[model samples]
Target: MRGLASASVADQLIDVVSRIAVRDLATLRRYFPALSPDEIADKLVVGTARATEAVGAGVGTAAALPTPPAMPAELAAGVLGAATVECKLIAELHVVYGLRAPGNVRQRAALYLAEWTEGRA
Candidate 1:
């Protein structure tokens, strides 16, 4: 059923966001050393919940149609923006730590996400 399918998608999105947010706290604190642990935790919790809600709303909207539409532009834009921010932060951290990666922003981001998710699994 459409409702079931939508629910499944929402669950997956939430799970991914939750996992990433939990793991990202360390990185967040590392990048923002001035922030207290409580501050980082609060940001992770609120940001992940907000992202999950946005993605869930997008999925619900698509599921209501007689035929599913292409992925919404707003959802796509949000995803891209999030990924870019993550990549930029990571790259900056690498620089701060005197580390190096092999490629451009897109390539490095793709590799980082791949490795990050793989570790989660």
Candidate 2:
């Protein structure tokens, strides 16, 4: 069922985001020592935009190729990819601002998901 697929996707995304490594302050500093916060944010925004677009394009391509029954799976994959990319962007922006959430990974991930949901609403 569609509902089942959606719930599975949400659970998997929560697990993935909670575990995925986002750049920390020190990591960002090492890689972008010369960049200002604004510059870092611009980079993050650009990268996120590209990744989101890629996910959209992937879904579009799959829709053009797959049978109707396969279309839903491709749709779900698109949703998952977009959410993961957006969550990573949110986490990176928090780092750029020197305000990465202070909690265990799961708690921090929940905050990012909440932010994502809020933005969608």
lDDT (CA) per prediction? 0.50, 0.87
Identify the leading candidate in terms of lDDT: 2
Models, CA RMSD each: 10.2, 2.1
Model 2, runs deviating above 4 Å: 1-7
lDDT of 1 at 85: 39
Measured against the true structure, the TM-scores of the candidates, in listed sequence, are 0.39, 0.86
Q: State the lDDT of candidate 2 residue by residue for 1-121, as single tens digits.
A: 9999768776787888897679987787787789998998888889999999999998999899848999878987897788889999999999889888878998898789889989999
Please, what are the lDDT tens digits per residue for candidate 1 over residues 10-121?
Answer: 4444334333322234556675688765565455546645765676676566656665355464455455445433434444444434464576544555555554345346
Weakest 10 consecutive residues of candidate 2 by summed lDDT: 5-14
lDDT of 2 at 81: 86
Superposed by TM-score, candidate 1 places the C-alpha of residue 46 at a distance from the truth, in angstroms, of: 2.4
